[model samples]
Target: MTKHNNLQSISVRIAVKTPAVSRALEEIVSTLDGFEQQLDEKATQTDVLVLEVGDNPAKEFETVRALLEDGVVNQVFLTSAKTTTDILLPALRTGAKQFFQQPLVFQEVQQAFVDIHKERIAGEGIAVEKVSIKPGKMVSVLGAKGGVGTTTVAVNLAVSLNRLYPEKTIALVDMNRVLGEVTVFLDLQTEFNWDELVKNISRLDPAYLAKALIQSAPGLYVMPAPNSIESGSQVSSQVMKQVLETTKNSFDFVIVDAGTQVGASAFRIFSSSDTIALITTLSLPCIINVKRLLGTMRLLGSIPMNNINIIANRFEKKSAISLEDTEKMTGHSVYSTLPNDYQKTLEAINTGKPLVDVAKNSQLVKSLNKLAESLIVKEEPVVKRKSWFW
Candidate 1:
């Protein structure tokens, strides 16, 4: 009962104009338990109600005014196909918090709604959290047939974030069972492998975790694959979930360096990740593989139907295929691409250090910085940038 009164200070009412918009909003906000409500709004008193009137920017403006004029509504979100200045500007000026585009990704919407709710409650002196990523980012950096810099990108992303947010606990996981290169990349001799931890996973505790793990850098813990163990010796899917859950309690962001191979264990690990960074190139075969992987994941309930974004690694702008056709062929829009800086990426890998550590401003680093920033802030659609198709 005390918790109930305590939570009224953070109570939020989400309002939608059309049924379609209401349905879309539900896809994300349905998980929020406390005092979150979805109402067919009639311009009445409400706090932090999202007012989304799609396509009609004029109506969106009136809705915002209606919300602003009332003392009840604290924050308003306008979802429209028109995200341009002319349409989004007025809404922004009206103190609207976010401008959501059509065909909304639920993750993005979920973030915005959480932000508004937190702000509304926090303004009233109740504590609130702004953006909460689901504990860890399950980022798979699959090389496009082994030449692309997949592992390099994954390692650097993890290391860079550990450096960027030094206060927060970060983990680097090498999910490649047999020949994981993350151990080599960091120059850390393997003291323990993933197999040892999972072997005694049923008795997993803080002390057990301490013994089974290693620390090579500040604020960074590593879960390296076995030095002598093979894939068949790996822990089962149930054990994998247990390991990740325990890791989440100890770490804020878990960066997985899973190699590009669709195996039972790889699929098992990815099923628990918050974001699956599918690294591929603009080549037909790789892109086709991405399509196949996307379908396979969807079939197995591993990848969320809407969350998978195609990342074009080592992509160049002068390739045979345009980015548009690549998007069309894969049926998933490219999230962002890294420059085809083979030499720079190779140097970083050979040296066993993050590109951000050695070269902060390289084209590859610049692109990764953008990628990490987007993931940390967790705004979508993951910032689709252009590059040459390789």
Candidate 2:
């Protein structure tokens, strides 16, 4: 396939509000690569598709909503006649990258074509493999014991990522349905829970996924557990995998709050995460479990030795084990030790607000910020393989 001047190549569906708009946009987009047709969505691989949805604004909105929900269309071009601010807002609200108020601009048309050409050129220049995560990074945060404050770390860490990477997407998944109060901690309304999402698992798209996770910030999304346990999802590893795979494609990061019983789905998520943060304190048995989990992961090759980082939560200077001693005992460096700010953390928890918002500069919040930075900016360094003889 000699790739050039063919928008149908990439499969990014560009939908317009009307038939005329669709026809007009097609005339413009066909000149570019990877732009596919709305009809061909199922038949062909549409990296980007252009559609003129003027045929039915309401239906168009619904269709567009579903597309964005499913993370199908990479980029969108909105066109309407004397369009109201209301018309364009919905598309933009759902993350349509570029919108056109007036009919196809000769300059924008030219520019859009130019941009596509440049992307193709740049594609050749870079040798990076496309690592596609549906919504974001799915980092499974589980507790060693019941009261290890796993949800606390998960929610704040997610909030931190939202603040730090306001440009990228991050999701905090409360896997602990019964007791998982991530929503309560963040003070977000638990109107829609895991069941609603699981119901639409087949069509779990970006637009839908975005709505599923409460938008705590522009970049961060939170998928809280159900309010009442009367009829929630019996989420298995497969279900979690499907949701996670869809999330990986749409967002840059996904933080999972694994409440207890790291079995089935929980185990799978941890095994395949970019990073696995084991939140444990100085309790001897908890520490032992953390160590044992690490050893088990290494033995099973479920998690690489390097990707596992231990986080000592509610830490204080007066702790019995020094940082060095903790490291020695665990045989792993303590990534970040979050201080025990009882009043501060509790207040934030009670109010359902992030410490960053309530107690912004607190030591514990600062430590979480540092940890967030470490995850976002730090890249894996090359390591040498151990020789058999050694």
Q: Any residue pairs clashing in model 1, and if so which?
A: 316-388, 317-388
lDDT of 2 at 113: 44
Q: Which regions in candidate 1 have their CA more than 4 angstroms from the true location?
A: 1-137, 229-234, 377-390
Instruction: Give me the candidate number with maximum lDDT.
Output: 2
- Compose the digit string of candidate 2's lDDT tens values, residues 180-234: 6887887776466666667667646554564456666666667777766654446
- What TM-score does each of the candidates earn? 0.60, 0.63
**Number of clashes in model 2?**
57
> Could you tell me how far off, in angstroms, the CA of residue 234 lies in candidate 2 after the best superposition?
2.0
Candidate 1, run of 10 with poorest lDDT = 381-390
Give the runs in model 2 whose Cα sits over 4 Å from its true position: 1-136, 228-233, 380-390
Q: How big is the positional error of residue 372 in model 2, measured in Å on the Cα after superposition? A: 0.7
Q: 129, model 1: CA deviation in Å?
A: 22
